[model samples]
Target: MMRITVSFLPSELLPKPLGAVAPDGQDSGVLPATAIVIDVLRATSVVSAALANGAKRILTFADLEEARSHAMGLRDQQEAVLLCGERNCQPILGFDLGNSPAEYDRETVQGKTLCLTTTNGTKALQAAQPFEKILTASFTNAAAVVAALPHSNQPIHIICAGTDGSITGEDTLLAGRIVDACCKSFGAKIDNDSAEIARRYWLQDEQGQSLAERLRQSQGGRNLDRLGFGADIQRCAASDTINVVPQVTARSPMEIAMMR
Candidate 1:
């Protein structure tokens, strides 16, 4: 394995609420060729759909108060700033929208800026801040995100927005998909055991059960179900449904725009 940790390399890289797992057994410091942020339950999926539908930009914040402060400023500058986020899979009080992809329809989200703070996704973004390049992924846009990556044969890091500080199955599933995609696209090496395991998961049941069912089976998925948001899970798990790769690039504080 070209992956060696604590060789904790000279270069640095970066996740926040759904923080990246500690690189305990894997390479610690070497920066990945590219970092893939996964919040398969809803965050990245919603972002993909939001941008694809013409939403102006999504401003991510880990703190709800910070998001609120930014929302006020953005609203003052533009009338269309909407507060979107979740607290334990439910809408935050006084916010304009919940963290459901279906809620961000073209009519509501189009031509507007969404100030989003999710339980895991925004935290994941915070965690990935130091990364050279950050790309958001969800089953909803797996194929498109894979297609957008450079086939340069560099290491790809899949950062899962694990639920409540632990890995979630949905996030792993997409990471696996990305691993499989990279193997074919660039013959990328599976640097660690977790990455290899995720790849195997994606390989095991590509077409057996509906991805929605798999999502529903996850902790994040079941929580959504308990909250009567089963429909959101279906939307999140629909692979390749939206063909947008959300790349975080220069402009301003963590603004995600679809990379063409």
Candidate 2:
């Protein structure tokens, strides 16, 4: 019996093999299920774009120092290593790129190894490493994320990478979209109220505005806008724009790479 659990950030109420959707993390008592981390505002969206555009691999880190250490390694091994990340909705002091989907393209990201750290996205990825399998997702690659889900008997968990400590609407919307798809394609059961709310949202439309508009109104979206990242909000909102689902191929030094 495959069950689907959805939760924003991390908590203590639910833990273990039953499945979990968490944005933050738990070292101990964390679930042993497959974890899908969604950062629709920018992080995972940019990951999808980077992979789709031809980036060989993406190394995600919750801490800047660890990411920098890995970046130095990449620089030694490869001629061009792209250091991309954001802190408080702004690019790091010295990075090749910020957390923006539009910035990743065939010309810039192609054949480069990306070392990325983000305020929310990378944190979720690190925390989810204890799961059986880890996946990165966003509305930009929702279809690919769904397609990558295996039909195993194990439960499925969708984690929404919220802004700071709060649950952001954009990530929850993507989680809902994924949950709705899982229910349809895998016949997976939604086992919680949060998942139910997301599923209901996935079934409804935006009325007049787009999914992007809704994100722009969110606190996460407003932060990006205030940081002069209005362009990124639009790019990240477009659904199915990219077709790559980045699955965590390596956990220890965290590598989210597309299966080529």
Candidate 3:
């Protein structure tokens, strides 16, 4: 049976050998066959929007200056590149674009490479380097990501990019949504307590609150709202709006492209 696990924070994850099973009958050592990284508050959503809008590719970095420097190098070589990302829920100084899905329209990002850096999301992606296959997911492309999963018994892991080292409701909700979809579509079993908690949390109705409202209550959402980005929260709350699945195709610069 395929086992699905969820790591609510990047710190909770450890490199595991592929296909390894612990004495407790859980995944241990190197990561599983596939790993899905979720940062619903923004980063993964931005990747989905950029790719769907025809951006050539996205290169993620953990440092702000490194991303800017890389973008500069690409521009110096005459490559079409855009420096994109955020810090403290606001645009990095001088970046061409902030971490907003709406900013990555076809006219803005088409045929251009986006060099992105974010506080939590890009770090989560970097931490997931041990996985065999790495895919990015958000509310915008959750169904597409589930549809792209390989049909096999190999264990799959979901890594949530939490806010400031703390698990946030938005990422957990999306992770739970994916877990529920995988359970329904592939008959996969939730393999950890975190996964079970997320799945159950997603199944509950929060007293008539809309998805956007729920997101606004999350830590990341509140920060964005304080930065006057409530609209971005609404955009991120929309589910399955984008059909593209962004997968990590290269590791040297950590490039993400639409899965082929």
TM-score per prediction, in order, is 0.85, 0.89, 0.93
C-alpha-based local distance difference test score of model 1: 0.75
TM-score leader: 3
lDDT of each: 0.75, 0.81, 0.90
Instruction: Residues 1-260, candidate 1: write the lDDT tens digits.
Output: 22211101112223122233334655433344467788877888889889878888888888899989999997788668999999888899999998889888898888898889887787677666655677888887888887887665444667787887767788877787788877776667777777788888878954678778888898888888999999999888777878788988653568887785
- How many steric overlaps does candidate 1 have? 7
Candidate 2, residues 146-175, lDDT tens digits: the string is 887778776677877777768878878888
Error of 2 at 28 (Å): 12
Q: In candidate 1, list every pair of residues with a backbone clash.
A: 5-27, 5-28, 15-127, 15-128, 16-123, 16-127, 17-123
Error of 3 at 215 (Å): 0.6
Across 123-193, the per-residue lDDT of candidate 3 in tens digits comes to 78877887878999999899999999988887789999998889999999999999999999999998999
Output the number of the lDDT-best candidate: 3
Please give the lDDT score for candidate 3: 0.90
Please give the lDDT score for candidate 2. Answer: 0.81
Give the per-residue Cα lDDT of candidate 2 at 246.
89
List the RMSD of every prediction in angstroms.
5.7, 4.2, 3.0
